[model samples]
Structures are given as structure tokens and as C-alpha cells.
Target: MTTVVVADDQGLVREGLELVLTARGCDVVGVAADGREAVEVVRRTLPDVVLMDVRMPVMDGIAATGEITRSGLPSRVLVLTTYDLDAYVYGALRAGADGFLLKATPPDRLVAGIDTVAAGEALLAPSLTRRLIEHHVRGPAPVVGRPAALAGLTEREHEVFLLIAQGLANDEIAEALVVSSATVKTHVNRILAKLGTRSRVELVVLAYESGAVRPGGA
Candidate 1:
């Protein structure tokens, strides 16, 4: 069974999630009332996934996510946010959260999100994609020149990276590029390695932050 830590300040939400996860056959290894406790428990339990709420006392999810990721812990984080357009949530994602889900997500999708993260795939909700494009990618940010991290990618890999940032699945990318699924997967693997990114979500963050792709631009 997938193991998880549910971290949220609301006791009722925490309890409800624990119940739902357990019913779904996941092991709720720990529950934390805030981000600091979440980090501590994660360090101790090393669960497969962390269901983290963005706002918490003592520490917010963004800081906690940074700490967890910087520590290179095995556990992947899945942020929980009430607002789809919360700018801070993007900060958390950039801090290395595997993905995010709205607090209002249905129970099945919630369970599936945890499972997806546990399986080492980034899980950006479709609505979350729109928010990122509309809120973060629509405006101009300071460009320090094309990020050096992308210099190693070949033309094909660069193309794959843009499609990934566009929220296309691997199979879809394969179809769009007229490449085999295996070829697309190889390109993705190379892209992840070259970018030093742990998942597609980080790749998306890099794409936007580096201005490799922009909203409403080719």
C-alpha cells in the first residue's frame, strides 16, 4: 500500500483525509497539524508521499517543501491548497512539491493523486495548469538570459520540454511529434537528467521561470 503523511492545520480536514485514505487502502503513517510537524514526521517515517497543506503555523508549506526537497528525502510532496490561483502555491511547486491538488478534490482523485505521486509522476490538476498559465506565465519576468540549465538539451529534447510544460502527456507528445512512445519517453528521461529536475512539474517551473516558454507565444 502507498504510505502517506497528511498535513493540514484543520483538525476536521486532517481527520477526514485520514479516514478516506485508510478506507482507500493507503497507510496513513502520520498526521501533522502544521508544516513543521509535517517535516519532522516525514523525516522520521519517510513515507512514500506527503499530503501537505500550503498554509500552516510555525512553518508554511513552501518553506517546509524547500527543506524537504533540499534534504533529498525519499518522500515526494503533494501540496493541498484551497485556492487554485494562490501565488504561494506556485512557490511551493517550485520548491519541489511533486504536484498539487485542490482541497475540494473528490475523494477518488485525492487518493489517485497520492498514488500517482507515490509512483513518481507529477500530478498537476488540469485546473492548476490553467492557473499557472493565466497567473504566472502571462506576465513578463526578469530574464537573466536563457537559463544555463537548458543549455545541454538537444533540439528534440527542447521540444519535449516545451510540450511537457504545456501539460501534455507522454503519449500525446508522441502523437503530436509523430514519434514512438518509447522515443518520447527517452527524450523525457534525457530532458529530466539534463535539467536536473526530479519530475515534470519542476520542468514546468523551470520552463516558465527561465522564459523558455511564454503564455500566448510560439
Candidate 2:
């Protein structure tokens, strides 16, 4: 069973998330009412997933998520937020959150999102993903050059990364590139390896950062 820790300043929200996750066969390993405590519990429990609220006091989810990731813990964080436009969402992602989910999401989607993140995949809704892309695109470009990371990718691998950043799934990428789905998967794997990223979410970040693709720019 996947183990999860729910962290929210609101007791009711924590309890509700715990109940739903537990009913779905996820072990609710711990609960915390503040970000500091959440970070401590995550370090101790090494849970498979952390359901973190973005606006908690005493560190807040963005800082907590950063701590958890930098600690080299095995847990993946799934940020919970009531506001879709929360600025903390971008920081949390940069800090290595595996996914983000709106608190208003249905219970079933909540459970599925937990499972998805625990499995080392991101679960941002497509709309939220687009919003994140738009946000980053609107910002001034950073001075950092593309990491030497992209050096290891083959030409086809670069193509795959661009398609993924365009929000195409494996099958859709296959169709777009006129290749088989298996071939697309292989290209995706190579892209991830070359980019030194852990998930597709990071791939999206890198793609935007590298200016390989941009919001409203083809």
C-alpha cells in the first residue's frame, strides 16, 4: 500500500484528505497542521507521497517541499491548493513537487492523483499545466544557458521533448511524428535521461527554460 502524509493548517482539510486516501487503500501515515511539522513527519516516515497545502504557516508548503526534496527523501509531494493561481505552485514545482491538485477536486480524482504521484508521475490537470507554461513564458528569460544536459540527447530525442512540452501524450506524439508509440516511448526515455529530469513535469519546465517551446509561440 502506498503511504501518504497529509499536511494542511486546517484540521478539517487534513482529516478529510486522510479519510479519502485511507478509504482508497492508501495508508495515511501522518498528518500535520503546519509546514514545519509536515517536513519533520516526512523526513521521519519517508512516506511514498505527501499531500501538502501551499499556504500553511511556519515555512509554508513551498519551503517545506524544498526541504523535503533537498533532504534526498524518497517521498514525492503533491501540492494541494484551493486557488489555481497560487504563486506558490511554481515554487513548489521548482522545488521538486511531483504534482499539484486543486483542493476542490472530487475525492476520486484526489485518490488517483495521490496514486499517480506516488508512482513517480505528475498529475497536474491539463489546464493547470497550460497555465504554468503561460506563467513561465510571460517572465523574462533567465541568463542561465541550457545546461550541458541537452548534449546527450539525439536529434529525435529533442523532437520528442518538444512534442511532450506541447502537451502531447505518447500516442499523440507518435501520430504527430509519424512513429510507433513504442518508438515514442523510447524517445521520451532518452529525452528524460538526457535532460536529467525525473518526470514529464520537469521535462516541461526544461523545455520552456531552454526556449524550445513557448506559450503562444508555436
Candidate 3:
């Protein structure tokens, strides 16, 4: 069963999420009222996933997510917030949140999101993904350079990274490159290993932060 820690400022929200996750067969290992407490609980329990709220006292979810991710812990963070603003989405993903879903999501989808993040894949709300694409095409040219870590990637890996960074699905990437899906998957795995990212969302963040794709296309 998936193990999870629910972190939200409101007591009722915490209780509600705990109940929902529990009923879905997830092991609700712990719940915290704030980000700091959430971080502490996660470090102590080392659960598979953390359901973190964007806004909380002591430290916000973004910072807490950073703390957990940078700690080298095995836990993945899933941003479970009411807000779906671009700022929050960017902040959470850049801070290493493996998934981002609005609280208005149905319980079944929320549980599926937990499973997605637990399996080390990304789960973004459809609207959030749409917003990202819109901003990518219209947002201002951010002043940033390609990350030096990318130098470690092979030529094929770099090509794969660029495509995945633009939010293409694995099969889409394969079709674009005229390669098998398994080949694309292998390239993706190598890119992740070389870049030291845990999820594809991190890749999207890096691409945007580095201005690697630009406003038009790669």
C-alpha cells in the first residue's frame, strides 16, 4: 500500500484528507498542521509521498518541498492546494514537487495522483499543464542560461530532454523522433539520471529557467 503524510494548515482539511486517503487503501502515516511540522513528520516517517499544501505557517509548501527534496530523502511531494495559480504551480514544481493537483479534485483522482508521484512519475492537473504551455509561448524571455549539468547528457539524451521539457508525452516524443516508445523511455531515463532530476516537471522547470526552449520552439 502507498504511504502518505498529509500536510495542511486547516485541521478539518487534514482530517478529511487523512480519511479519504485511508479509505483508498493508502497508509496514512501522519498528518501535520503546518509546513514545518510536515517536514518533520516526513523526515521521521519517511513515507512514500507527502500531500503538501501551498500555504502553511512556519514555512510554505514550496520551501518545505525543497527541504525534503534536497535532504536526499526518498519521499516525493505532491502539492495539494486550493490555489492553481501559475506562481504556485511554478514554485511547487521548481522546488521539486513530483505532482500538483487542486483540492477540488475528486477523491479518486487525488488518490491516483498520490500513486503517480509515489511511482516517481509526474501528475499535473490538465489546466495547469495547459497554463504552462500558454506561458511558454507568450511569457517574457527569462534571462537565464542552460544549466551546466546538462553537459553530461549525450547527444540523443539532449534531444530527448529538449522534447520532454516541452511537455511532450513519451509516445509523442517517440513519434516525433521516429523511434520506438521503449527507445524514448530509455533516453528519458538517461536524461533524468544525467540531470539528477526526480520527475519530468523538474525538467520543464529547468528548461524554462535556463531559457533553453525560448518563446517559440526548440
- The C-alpha TM-scores of every prediction are 0.71, 0.73, 0.70
> What TM-score would candidate 1 get against the native?
0.71
Tens digit of per-residue lDDT, candidate 1, span 1-218 = 99999999999999999999999999999999988999999999999999999889999988989999999999999998897765765797789888888888899888878886787777787677756666665577738667887888999999999988887766678899999967987898889998888777677767887878776552
Pairs with backbone N, CA or C atoms under 3 Å apart (clashes), candidate 3: none
**Residue pairs that clash (backbone atoms under 3 angstroms), model 2:** none
Instruction: Point out where model 1 deviates above 4 Å.
Output: 135-137, 140-187, 190-198, 202-218
| Deviating ranges (above 4 Å) for candidate 3 | 139-199, 202-218
Better of 1 and 2 by lDDT: 1
Model 3 CA lDDT for position 106? 99
Off by over 4 Å in 2: 139-163, 166-187, 194-198, 205-218
lDDT of 2 by residue, 12-80 (tens): 888888888888899999999998999999988999999999898988998999999998999999998
What are the lDDT scores of the predictions, listed in order? 0.85, 0.82, 0.85
